[model samples]
Target: MLFFVALLVDGILAGSVYALVALAFVVVYRVSRVINFSLGEWVTFAARLVGTGTHALALPLAGALAFASAGMAALALAFNHVVLHRLIGHPPISLVMVTIGFGAVLQASTVLFFPAGSGAISLPVPSEPIEIGGLFLVPGKLVAAAIAGLGVLIVARVYRTRTGLALRAIADDPQAAMASGIDIDRHVVLTWSMAGVIAVVAGTLSAAVWGGGLSLVLVGLKVFPIVVVGGMDSVAGTVVGALLIGVLESEAAGYLNPVLGAGFSSLAPYLVLLGVLLVRPYGLFGTPGIERI
Candidate 1:
């Protein structure tokens, strides 16, 4: 029971970082219906920017994270205004391809420019662990989880606001929303902007947790299952999905890793994703779309 409890907490901590990543996906998807396949690149980019701040600008970790967050948000907004806007009328497939190309370009740019991030990154946090009710927790992970929880809370609260409803309106049907004078373009920009900020939070916390590098971009791929399981369009479902995957992944790593050989834990999330798809095509919380045709 104690072991189970510990694993549960660990999973929650890990899932917290993933939740932010999934939220980044959900935010943009809600308004644009575009997957932003390259979204993970921004996570890697932001993590790299932190290294830039610490080395070039001599900023501390907190300052570096702050700088990276602002920079990423600005970059996302600019990308929306310049690139996405230009491709507004293109086919969805074309947009997805563009995102794939953009990801490649961003990856290349990151390698050429942010050399510090080519390899694994290590963030220094206190070595001491926090013990509660016979369970020990890492301080860094606890902090990251707290921050992630707050981000989730804020997002949930936002849905109740006027602007948030307008954003949802765009998500329901961009064309109809536009006809209703909801200013689809502005909402799209806002969603992307939020995604950028969410990326930084996810990336930075991930670095502080396991580490950071170009590999962190795989975190993007990992989010597919999360959003699918949690309901790609449902914020509350995202939280539940992250928690479920986190717990399962952690448990697999701890128990199955030794029995099934190493790396089995890594495959756990995808297995859950497959199961979810089989059981509920629309996801545990995702809304079912009605086809006019």
Candidate 2:
């Protein structure tokens, strides 16, 4: 029982990270209706920036983080104004393929810039573990979880504001929003910028926990199951899904891994995604689509 409790706690904390990343996906989708497959590349790019700022440039922790945030935000805005902006009114398939190509470009760029043999980027957090009632937790993980929770709160609060309402209107119907004088381009750019910030924060915190590496891009892929299970359009659902997936993954790692061999935890989220799709095709909070032939 105690062991299970520990697993649960760990999973919740880890899930918080996924929740943050998933929120980025939800935010972009809500506004632009684009899947933004290159999101992982953005995250990888931010992580690399953080690593370079700290390790190579020798910037202070706070400065490195700020630099990463600004850099990512700028990159996102540029991608929107330069690439995506030109492709407006094109087929959704074209945009998706462009994002995929962008991700490949980012991956190749990272390899070119950082080259092979780049070591782990060290975070400023202490190496000590925190003990709470006989349970030990990594300080970095705890801090990251706290940050992720705060991010969720901030985003939730934003949804109540006028700007959020405008974004929501655009999401509901772009044509209607444009008719109402809501600048679709402006809102899309703003949404992309926000997505950039979220990706940076999540990527940096994840790097703090696991260290910066090329593989950090995979974090974006992990968020897919999270948002899908929670309902792509529902922020509340995203939070719940993240927590559920996190705990289940933790449990699988702690108890099932030894018996089932390693890697079960990694596969747990997808299994849940399949189950959710089969049972609730629209997701827990997603509105069911109706079509008449």
Candidate 3:
């Protein structure tokens, strides 16, 4: 029915957005084992930078996007090298708290320097929505989703290559990986770099769909549920989780509106996330690793 179709579209869009952000979280966690509470701020930062460059500075869209991405990448590198690297070997809880504190500092700084209040900003990408059989699909969302999917493939391929294998080994055991001649510091830095790129991708797509500025800041938190549903360690699970959550949420909003109160649909992903965590704490594809007696 038409109702079902609408729901499907909404869910896909939501899921795609979550998946892209979640990809960054999973990547960072795999490499550093640090849960970045500020991941969403990076998306917001990139979006605002691109938006401000294009709208305020009058740069071309391509130039704006590129400059914003580069700036974010640089910041990511700085965080890894200057901040996080020094905190290694600290207590896990202490390290996590530090990152959370780091995120707060970044958020405050963003407000002070940028001073751009939250509102939607248009993306630099094309604006024409796609239509199929009379239903309109947001072209920006579709394009972003496609790009994220392609990125997963490319990233996977990289994981199989020598450098990527080394990264994985480092993730599995830092001391052993270093003993085997893998550069742990470099791998960690590289992981942050890769995550920065993905965050830029997510930020770009988000600005296209939802505009830019402070509105995009919370995208990092939005990724939590997606990564939770998708096994944190499984790339394929991320893709699957995105699609499922996206479509389901969309459809729920459309069809269940009459039965449930307004805004109920928006809660679908979190509900699913909670349910999954309570039921399968390791996540859908996450393994239950054990220690020897």
Candidate 4:
């Protein structure tokens, strides 16, 4: 029982990071209706920026994080202005494909610019392990989880503010919002910028957990299941979905991996995702849309 509890705790800690990444996806989708397939690339880019800033530039950890955040926000704005801006009226499929292509470009750029042999980026947090009544926890993971929780709270609070109301209005009816004198383009840019910043924070926390590198980009792909399971348009659902997936993955890895011969934890999320799709296509908290032909 103690072991089970330990695993559950660990899963929740890990889920906090996943929740942040899924929240980033939700933010962009809510505003622009774009899935932002290139989100993983942005995360990878931010992680690389931090790695570069810390190692090559020899800056303090705080300084490196600040630099990465600013750089990512600028890049997001530039991408929005230069590429996304031109494709505003395009179909959703077109937007998704463009983002996929952008992700490919980012992957190539990361390979070309970052050092081929660069190892893990060190964070400033303590490396000690905390043990309590036979349950052990890593300080870094605890800190990351706390930060992620705090971030979610801040985002939730944002939804109550005037700017968030404007954002919600744009999401509900872009045409009506524009008619009301809301600057859709400007708001879209701001949403993307906010997503970029969130991506940086998520990537940094994830890198601290799994070590920094291009591999961290895969975390972006992992977030899809969380978003899908939670409800694409529901921020609160993201938190619940993250925790559910995290716990299931942890339990599966602990109990089933030996029989399944490993890698079960990674596969568990997609399995849940499939089940959610089959049972509730719109997701647990997603509202089904009604269309008249």
Report each candidate's C-alpha RMSD, comma-separated, in the order given: 2.1, 1.8, 2.4, 1.5
Once fitted onto the true fold, the runs of candidate 4 whose alpha carbons sit more than 4 angstroms away are 116-119
Which scores higher on TM-score, 2 or 3? 2
Clashing pairs in 2: none
Q: What TM-score does structure 1 among the candidates reach?
A: 0.92
Kindly report which residue stretches of model 2 are placed more than 4 angstroms away from their true locations once superposed: 115-123
Q: In candidate 1, residue 6 scores what lDDT?
A: 89
Q: Each candidate's TM vs. the true structure?
A: 0.92, 0.94, 0.89, 0.95
Please, what are the lDDT tens digits per residue for candidate 3 over residues 1-293?
87677667767766767787788877778878888888878887777777677777878777876777788878889988888888877888877787787778777777877746432455445677677887887766777777766777787788899998897787778889989988877787788888887777788777677666666765567677777777777677787877787786677777675689777777777889999989987678766567799
- Indicate which candidate wins on TM-score: 4
Candidate 2 per-residue lDDT over residues 87-167, each given as its tens digit: 888999998998899989988887889735332555557879988987999888898999999999999888889998998
Q: Compared to the true structure, candidate 2 yields what TM-score?
A: 0.94
Candidate rank order under lDDT: 4, 2, 1, 3
**Clashing pairs in model 4, backbone N/Cα/C closer than 3 A:** none
**What lDDT would candidate 2 get against the real structure?**
0.84
Q: Cα lDDT of model 1 overall?
A: 0.83
For model 3, the superposed segments whose C-alpha errors exceed 4 Å read 115-130, 291-293
Off by over 4 Å in 1: 117-125
TM-score result, candidate 3: 0.89
lDDT of 1 at 75: 89
The better-scoring model by TM-score among 1 and 3 is: 1
- What would the per-residue lDDT of candidate 4 be over residues 1-293, giving only the tens digit for each residue? 99899989999999998899888888888888888888788788888888788888888778888888899889888887898778888887888998899999988998899885342565567898989889889989999999999999888888779888889999889889999999988888888888888988888888889877778777788777888888988899899999998898889989999899698888989988899889887788876777999
